[model samples]
Target chain A: MKSTYLALILVLASAPLWARTTPEELAEHPRWKALLHINQGTTWRYQGRSYIDDPDFFLHESGATDARAELEASIEQLRSSESEARCDFPARYRFLSQQLDWPDDGALSHCSEYQEWRGAMPEERVALIFPASYLNSPSSMFGHTLLRIDHGEDEDGVWLSRAINFGATVQGQENSILYVYRGLFGGYPGYFSNVPYMNKIRDYAHLENRDMWEYQLNLDEQEREWLLAHLWELEDIEFDYLFLDENCSFRLLELINLARPESGLMNDFRLAEVPANTVSSLDRAGFIESVDYRPSKANELDALVKQLDATEQDLALALAADHAVTEREAFRELEPRRQNLVARTAYAHLRLQNREGERSQAAAERGMALLRTINGTPTVSGIEPERPVSPEKGHGTKMLAAGGGMLGDRGFGELQARFSYHDWLDNPDGYLNGAAIEAFNARIRRTEGDDLTLEQLDVVNIKSLAPRNSFRKPVSWFVNGGLDRRFIGEKRHLTRHIQGGPGLAWELGPVMPYAYAMARAENNSAHEVLVSTAAGARAGVLWYADGFQLGLEAEGLYYHNDDRRYRPSATLNVPLGRNHALRARIERDGGPDRAETEFHLSWRYYFD
Target chain B: MRKTLLAAALVATSFGAQASAPGGSGCGWGNMLFEGNDGMPMHVLATLVNGTSGNRTFGITSGTNGCDTSGALSYHGENMLAQAGVMEEVAQDMAVGDGEALTALSVSMGIPAEERDHFKKTMHENFSTIFPSEDVTAEEVMANIQKVMNQDKQLASLS
Candidate 1:
């Protein structure tokens, strides 16, 4: 299962088909598809509204989801309608006055005619409720099972999810909802006790994407980069997103590229105290603020809750006095509210009392504040925006150079050996560019047994636009493959093959859909043939906007391999440099064996 | 809208049967489990039907139908007792015109006094409350139940 999943990841990752078939598959996943298709042929902007329809709550914070504002207006309408309801619906209104409680069980199975399409959806249709549910069923946390529905018959349907997870990105997909948050993978779990029914619900979601990669999120600095590269290598497989459950917060920050973007790193410690700053011991003050929040004894909410609790108690007593109730009777009515106030006071008091005592609260709070100082904030001191805290002082590579290989073009073989080095730019946007080859090399094992030896530097190009703010610059890509027929001993029998191509690259957003198209040539030394062409294309979106790149290419070959059985095939028609891209690839020759199905995965690097 | 109305009609026609609930003190497993007038009993599978689109969908409604203790449930006399309890509750709650009580008694399955209460509560809450009736005699309730279940086709206008 694991291997099959790995193979699937490699295959699906490489296929550039973000735009493909639907209509039929639409029936199966109507909700999510509906959200996408709703504003088709529309750009990122429609009128003044954003064209990006990720029904998640991000837009809700801005109060943008209510396009018509009917709900907003309903609140005002309620006041005036009360008079008419009292006059004409005395009895009808009475039922609603206390909110008639029906048998919860009876209602679950039987929805009234009043419910519309998004009715008691559990039975109507299976809804893919996102971030609302992580792993366990709501029964554990909430008493009953919660199934999200946008519309329903008797119940207020039209809501998105029935069951939800905490702090999840519950997007309202047209056909189904999906969570895109950090620590959510695995699959939705049903309630612990609901057994058979809950089990059935789990079975319905069908989360058997056997190829998902699992890793602990709490890795140290070196291991963090180490794992990210591994994640990048296995990018060929399809997955919703990576969930850095344990250390996602910091792990994600470390992956940021400050150089290409901002082109500098904040003095992680006190800038003045930096080892190189020996001047005044890098003013610890400069960094102390980064890890600390300006703390005050009394917070705004703490003061407010205290005052409100007292005020409410007094009001309750006054109300009782006005009605002439027993002191004890009135106190009961006012008690819970007062208790609620007390709870708030206790919470705030603890926050203030727990300041900087023996516990590390003071230190942790200071640390958090310090992070905010340097996070996304421009400099407060005289530091240049592009200045690095340590600069490239400790950053240099000892390249493991590779000896040149021979490439036989048509009739003759050519050999060339060269040296090249790549640097690790802390910008995530450059994760796919040809600049960060150094970082890539540190992660995966492209070569077996021994540490990978970098041979001749055939090509490297890494460009940056706003690297931080603006994501418009197009980074070019280049690839070179060469064959070593001799001297390599064990690899002697294999003909040397080398090919290089360079093209433009662009990322739609940070860790988002990325693309690069380049033209290049390939040659085999032992076979004595050089095939060249500009008709190759590779493209696919990175999953969850992560650094994983997926692409597919169909190229017309310059020279075909003569393995008698395994014919290396590429797809294209225009003999060589047609304006058309590397078209739909076809496996024309399945080697000497008439028919075969196969997929390939290659590790990559970017040197900026 | 159409689905909701259709679903409502099915609810109306099913003629829910409820049994009176026996008293509450340290009730045994069966008593505590079956006390649910609103939800499914622990062992008793509740077949909830939510028919929208007016499609009267009949999902496998497997249970001790008729409460006859046959099929896989034949071993337990609970079904038979439950059925009789239901009939007794109806007869007791809706005692009819003078001589009618005797006739109902003849047809009654003879449930115990204790079990009768369970039927009454079940009937009241398991949704027998849908067709509201005030001061309905014993024979009338029995007759109505029979007619709904297709055992008796006769209908008597209130006098």
Candidate 2:
């Protein structure tokens, strides 16, 4: 048998890598990247060495009245689920056979027979043999280190696989001819990606997988859109994924961002549209509870007026009086999802105004969010509320209950704020640039200094921040004035006006040292309409300095107006001290033109 | 019998012509070192003709100039000469080498490793960088290690 294999190897080794696909490559075929890793489970880690092996900790965490009962129940459920799910490998090897090959001690002989039977066919002279050790859930890591390779080779050339990333060298027995199946990348069902970056590949897969037909099922695009109508339903419903189990917590978030790649439109009604529709339909069908999120504007207005009367002038400030602008910016970026927290507080007051015994309405539209009242107090969770996860009720908290993410929120925000910066080293024409309005923000707070400041766990005075922002520019160079409704925690409020306008976007070029053009015609008095066109391209080696961002956007925007409006903006984001960002830009905003001649220099703390 | 031998020789000669084509012999073969570690017997895998030596027969654990890449030889017998002592034992019984060159070769040639982390930390990144053929990898060109293990001490296992 060994000699037969050796003879076969010699013939295969001598086989000139056929121009056509080889047997091994064809074995992997279109779905070669989909070998499941039958290991990497949480239970394996929980048993000992990696984490808490203490029985006390396990008992405390499980929260089950009876630990043994919980374990038995869990096992039963897993087996049931396993039975319900489709068996990945063919059925011939489902039961152990009498005699076969290496590793398998007289098991899966039928599998070998099957391989022989399949190999007998003339069209394709190959069979994908399933080693017996892998027959039981080949998706897990312990099941098998399986792979398919391109077996084409001339004595001169050989073909290899590029899917697997090995943790360490193989034991010389099996070649590193494959990529491992750690988990899903993007939203691809039962598949992994070979993309270079771990997260980047996951993100790309996420964005592309959103539109898969598997996600649609019998529902048309309109039904999907209908389900997305409610904010909660839109955010909560995941059609394509029959199982909510994503690659990992970190990967899930990265995939979410990937799915929502175009960050400029975060609250994009696209996904929300269908998810909301489903929630409404499901609620009507009595599957999920019909949440009450709608609250009256009158209730909010009344509460504001009463707070104004009740508070002494100094008593009302956004958070504590000791907090600085930097602190507020810190809070805004740190707790962006605090929008729900504030909404919950507002609903508390709205609930009081409701008629006796009548249910109060919900104010926020995101149906995916849940609101719970604790001793007449209310709060909200962004993705999933961290209430006691009632398995019987079929609910749980978010994977990222604590998004203690963002290495440097403040720094990241600042770097992001310089959003629309271009270095004219490359393209000189059609280019679009603008800082996302996530930069426009406020930190709301309330004060109770003279009162018995929470005597329990509460301190004499405390501060908390909540983020608020919204603004988009269309065909620029127009004055846009708006108002800021600031809040000091649960009480004091303030509103202010904002005014600014004028914006332009041009298409950059394929022409080397390209000269791009831009045209403007908004004759509104609130805005200025001056045809300003300037294109001078300089050649500088464009490359990224630190991290993955390419520092290659440089060009002089020379407006032909009386004063040459040169917005020569170039900012280099130097991740200096722990995301302690240092940015510098040089722009001749008004050089021999009537455009505003001001060198804009602004610096602020990023994440607190 | 003479005609059959001639026909076979003619067919083999035609292989040379085909080898010269794109994705042919020139792109095959990644750099392989005579790994001397633990109980591993140093065996020559292939002889690279960097300089001419008239193809004189050489024994295992023996080489005049083929081991030295800088030397000008016509044939490298049974192994791609490598800078010695490059492969090192990291910890207890654990060996690690800058096998990127081998890795790129393996990946490009479709020779997956039996032990994933065994010969990792590849230095040769681009499979196409060293060789012209897109079809070759270190796995295919690598001499069967078992053959190397079982061969006569005098004769190299592969070349």
**DockQ values for all predictions?**
0.02, 0.01
lDDT of model 2 at residue B43?
17
Model 1 Cα lDDT, one tens digit per residue, A391-438: 112222223311121122111111222122232222222012223322
DockQ of the two-chain complex in candidate 1: 0.02
Candidate 2 Cα misplacement greater than 4 A, ranges? A1-86, A89-534, A538-563, A567-576, A584-588, A591-608, B1-155
Distance from true location, Cα of B146 in model 2, Å: 14
DockQ of predicted candidate 2: 0.01
State in Å the error of residue A392, model 2. 40
Candidate 1 local Cα displacement, residue A251, angstroms: 34
Q: For all candidates in order, state the fraction of native interface contacts they contain.
A: 0.02, 0.01
Q: Report the C-alpha lDDT of model 2 over A164-234, residue by residue, as the tens digit.
A: 11111111122112212212111212211111111111111111111100010122232222121111111
Error of 2 at B32 (Å): 22
